[model samples]
Target chain A: MTQSAGLVAEAILPTFTEAVELHKSMVFSIAWHFLRDRSRAEELSQDVFLELHRRWGSLRSAEHLVFWLRKVTGNRAIDMIRSRKVRPETSLDAAAEPTTLEQMHDSLLASYLERMVATLPEKQRLAIVMRYQEDLEPDEIARILGMNVSTVKTNIARALSLLQAKTVGRLQPNTARRLNEMPGETGK
Target chain B: MTPFEQELKRALARQQPSADFTERLFARIEEEQAAAPVRWWQRIAQWPAQTIWALAPVCVLILLTSGTMLYTQHRRAVQGEHAKQQLLLALRITSNKLQATQRQVNEVESERQPNQKDNIRRLL
Candidate 1:
């Protein structure tokens, strides 16, 4: 009995460890992007993994595990937002002097866009993150979020529009025109 | 994809957890395992440590219910023994009284027999 128990433990421990190693980034990033607080995000990520451990036996396949992680992380993030009433942080003005001139412009634009996405409504922000950051399909996002696929697509579209308006509305005309010329503005 | 969306994706790429995250999680799991009550079924199933904590109240409830039942059975057994002893004592007392009444009847019958024999001799 002891030997068999030891064997089972050996098999399970490595599998669980591998799973955690594989999916930690997805779990952590979802929390970080949603909460925007490094410590809280880390804590939330830990809690999610612990939950995953508890429910590990119920997960049947690798794909199911990934889906479960996304759904749980997304739901937990939204719950955290609701419970904490966290106001979105909007201060994106601080840009460090870039070592290289070429990378500076792109980094600034990226940071600005990230802030805009962060400030969106919770569902829209979550959808956008899942769509772009996670690069998940609308159907996958809908499954994770328990929403209609059409609703998920609609949320992403609305989020893009809102971001475009916010970005272009705030920048100087020349800069706005430049941003509008960017590929995301074309609604691809 | 729009340049803005592309940039957003680049900026919001998946971030890794801290270097010691797995280690810390394992440590917490170990601590929980150590704290949880040991049970044969749990050991057999290798239940996650959090599950033991979650089921603590149920365990307590089961223990309480079983304890109460055992105590009730014990009290009933004691009461039954007491009643048995009381019935035996009552039966012994009744037996003694019946034996004393039988001895008094024997004495009366012996006294009547001697008197009847004397009266018959005198009449003859």
Candidate 2:
């Protein structure tokens, strides 16, 4: 009995550590995107990981691990929003500063689109950031934010409208044409 | 729900975190694990801390309420004691006046008795 118990404990220990490492990117990205600052995101992400360590026993599977992390990140962001007496200025759609992507020749239109997304309301901003920036689906965004499917849809809709409107006058004629050439640029 | 939504997703997915994220996270995690297991008391201290936090306001409220009640009662008792003393002093003064009036009446009666006795002897 003792041998079996020890084996089980040893087996579970590595898995817990592996789980934290595996989801760190997704967790950190969510926090950073919501907070719009790297340092705060890092701190928040560390808090989430610590919480995950504390609750390791209750999580049953890999899928549950991702679900819990995403959900907690969203809830924590919202809690941060509610609890804070002062809100710092954040530009959601702003392109990441001077990264390889910005230096690359391709996707200038996409960069413009990001700047437009930054002006959206916090909820809409988070939804769009998670959906597009993190490649999360609407349903997944709903799960993370603890909102119903329709509300998530509304947030996405409002975000896209804002992006489209902002992009119309900002992009040059050729870049605008290129953006419109994209498949989802126009209504069906 | 429109096509623009899809394009927005395509645009945003290109952004990624700095490459060193995984390496940093592992280093932090290992450092934490190598450290000592938190004492059981530390693990459980939040409950007691929260209990004390929650109880602090109630304790303050009870102290304030009891203090106010005791102060009011003390004031009322002092006032009652002061009124009783004044009433006793007033009664003492009234009793002394009454005693003085009685002594004067006794003196008058003695003087009137002597005058009446002389008149009666002369008439006999």
Q: Interface root-mean-square deviation for each candidate?
A: 6.2, 8.2
Candidate 1 chain A worst ten-residue window by lDDT = A1-10
lDDT of 2 at A101: 30
Per-model DockQ against the true two-chain complex: 0.24, 0.10
Question: How does residue B113 of candidate 2 score in lDDT?
Answer: 100
Clashing pairs in 2: A92-A118, A93-A114, A93-A115, A93-A118, A184-B3
Candidate 1: RMSD to truth: 10.5
Highest-TM-score candidate: 1
Score candidate 2 by DockQ.
0.10
User: lDDT per residue, candidate 2, B2-111, as tens digits?
Assistant: 44555566555532346676567667767886796767755654233346577789999999999999999999999999999999999999999999999999999999
Output the lDDT of residue A96, model 2. Answer: 35
Off by over 4 Å in 2: A1-14, A85-112, A181-188, B1-7, B14-124
Docking class of 2: incorrect
lDDT of model number 1: 0.75
Candidate 1 chain B: minimum summed lDDT over ten consecutive residues — where? B41-50
Q: Tens digits of per-residue lDDT for model 1 on B6-69?
A: 6668878777778999999888878876888757764534565456568889999999999999
